[model samples]
Target: MRARLGGLPTFVLLVGAAYCLFPVAWVVVAATKSTGELFSTTTLSVGTSLLANLGELGSYRDGVFWRWMANSALYAGLGALLSAALSGVTGYALAKYSFRGRALIFNGLLAGVLVPAVVLAIPQYLLLSKVGLTDTYLSVLVPGVISPYGIYLARVYAAASVPEDVVEAARTDGASELRILTSVALPMMVPGLVTVFLFQFVSIWNNFMLPYIMLGDDGKFPVTLGLYTMLKQGNTTPALYTLVVTGALVSVLPLIALFLTLQRYWRIDLLSGAVKA
Candidate 1:
């Protein structure tokens, strides 16, 4: 029974992997097909048009797809960076400091986490519109900079990772709070902050509704919104379907590259922490 139970988890994990990877596998296979072959061929079969599809995607609408990619990179990269910095500072403060209304503030953040972003989109749009910032890059970027979930993660991680004794010692040595945060606590919180950055990056990259509501210019649309437009257009011009598939495949590469690169840091940080502990 023990052996059977041990194998059960592995079976479940395999099933989960398949559930997640099957669609990705399908996209990979489908991207290789030409428009003519897309429906006629088997779902997983390879075709000859992968290069042609890529060339067409590049030339489509004066290469608007690449512009979408660049926009996504800007939004995700800058937004995640700002969010990580803010979350790290706020989280460290919440974890380390005692002050009036701290509990209330943290609880509010918790409440914010429970609230769906979809619910806030319209209000956010109205606020931006009041500032004449609607349909601009700032509109999409400003809201992503403050992630409640990221802040909560940072708070928890800071509490666990940063030792009070160490903080006290730094204070005793006459380091300012800012100095200590930058020089001490942040180093310890690198892994957690990396996690926060990655999460916020992926969230911003894949976000649809916020961009949909805020952006009027196709030129400023992120890859997600751009692909959505392409998918919509594909309904009328079916050949664009191949381009959409190819774009989807291409759009995913950056995220995959990011994960592969950052995962190394996560492992190193985690392993170093384990060794120290």
Candidate 2:
């Protein structure tokens, strides 16, 4: 009975992995197919038109597909970087400082996390519209910079990884608070911050609603929105199905690469934290 119980968790994990990866697997196979094969061939079967499909996708609207790709990179990459920085600073301050209304502020941010993103997104659009910022890149980029969840993670990480004595020592040596945070605390919190950055990046990358609500121009559309547009249009123009599939496949590669590259930092940070503990 105990053995069976232990195996159950593994079974659940495998099931969950398959549930998530099944679509990805489908896209890989589907992207290779020609429009005819997309409908006619086996769902999982490989097709020969991968290169041809890519070429077609590139030619669409004078390589707007690549433009979408660049837009996604900019939104996710730059947004995540700024969000991580703000999270790190905010988190470190919350963890290290003692001041008035600190708990209240933290609690408010926690509540912000609980509020549904859709709820906030609507208000964000309305507010940005008031300032003549709607339909602009800043509309998307600015809101993503302040992640309550990222700040929360950074606080937890700073609390765990940054020692009070080290902070005091930096202060004793005449380092400014900003200097201490940047030079001492930030490096220690890299692992957790990287995780935060990855989360924000993926969230922003996969985010359809915010950009969908914010941007009016197709040229400024991220891959998620761009693919959504393609998928929507595919209902009328069937050939676009292949382009959409290929774009979906191509779009995930950068995220996969970023995750793989930064994953090592997570391991190293864990080991270092363990040793410190």
Candidate 3:
């Protein structure tokens, strides 16, 4: 009975993996095909036109696809970095300090987390429009900077990972609050901060609606919106289908590389014997 139960869990995991990976597998195969082969051949068959498709994609609209890619990298990288910093500071303050209205603020953040981002898009747009910031890079980037979920995670992780004893010891050493945070608390918080960075990066990278509403210039569109525009165009120009598939495949490579690079940070146990003599 034990062996059967163990096998069942393994079997379920295998199925789940396949379910997630199958579309990725199809996209890989689809990207390699030429426009004609894409529809004429079987869904999973590999084709010989990958290089041709890549060349066309590069030359299309004077290489706007690459621009879209650069925009995505900028938005995700910068937005996540700023969000992580803000969340770390805010979360650490909430975790370590006893202050007025802290509970009220944290509770408000919890409520923010419960609210769907989609619901805020219109209101955010209206607010930015009043300031004449809409249709600019700041429009998309600013909204993502204050992530309620990221703040919440940072708070939980700071409470668990950073010890009060270490903080008090730093105070005894006459370290300024900023110095203590920079030198002591932030180091131990690296793993959790990394998680926050990765989460916000992925969220901003994959986000569509906010950008769709905020950005009017095609030049400022991220990869997600760029590919979406191509998909829309594909309805009339069928040949763009191959390019869309290829773009989808290429778009995922950076995310995979990022995860592989950051996975090592997750294993660091900075809290282990952190206060040892």
Give all candidates' CA lDDT scores.
0.90, 0.89, 0.89
Which lDDT tens digits does candidate 2 get at residues 1-277? 8879879899999999999999989999999999999999889989999999999999999999999999999999999999999999998888889799988998899899888878888999999899899988888888889999888878878888899999999999999988998899999998889888998999899889999988899999999999999999999999998999899999999988887888765432323322332
> All candidates' TM-scores?
0.92, 0.89, 0.92
Task: Report clash pairs, candidate 3.
Answer: none
Residue ranges of candidate 2 with Cα displaced over 4 Å? 1-16, 264-277
Q: Residue-wise lDDT of candidate 1 within 72-142, one digit each (tens)?
A: 99999999999999999998998889899998998898899787777899999888899899999989998
Model 2 weakest lDDT span, ten residues long: 268-277
**TM-score of candidate 3 to 2 decimals:** 0.92
List model 3 lDDT by residue over 1-277, tens digit each.
Answer: 9779989899999999999999989998898999999999998889999899989999999999999999999999999999999999998998889899998998998898777777888888898899999999989998889999888778877888899999999999999999989889988887889999999999999999999988989999999999999999999999999999999999999998998888875443334322231
Ranking by TM-score: 3, 1, 2
Candidate 1 deviant stretches above 4 angstroms:
1-9, 264-277
As a whole number from 0 to 100, the lDDT of residue 60 in candidate 2 is 97
Alpha-carbon shift of residue 180 in model 3 (angstroms):
1.3
Alpha-carbon RMSD, each predicted model:
3.8, 3.8, 3.8
| TM-score, cand. 1 vs. native | 0.92
lDDT of 3 at 160: 82
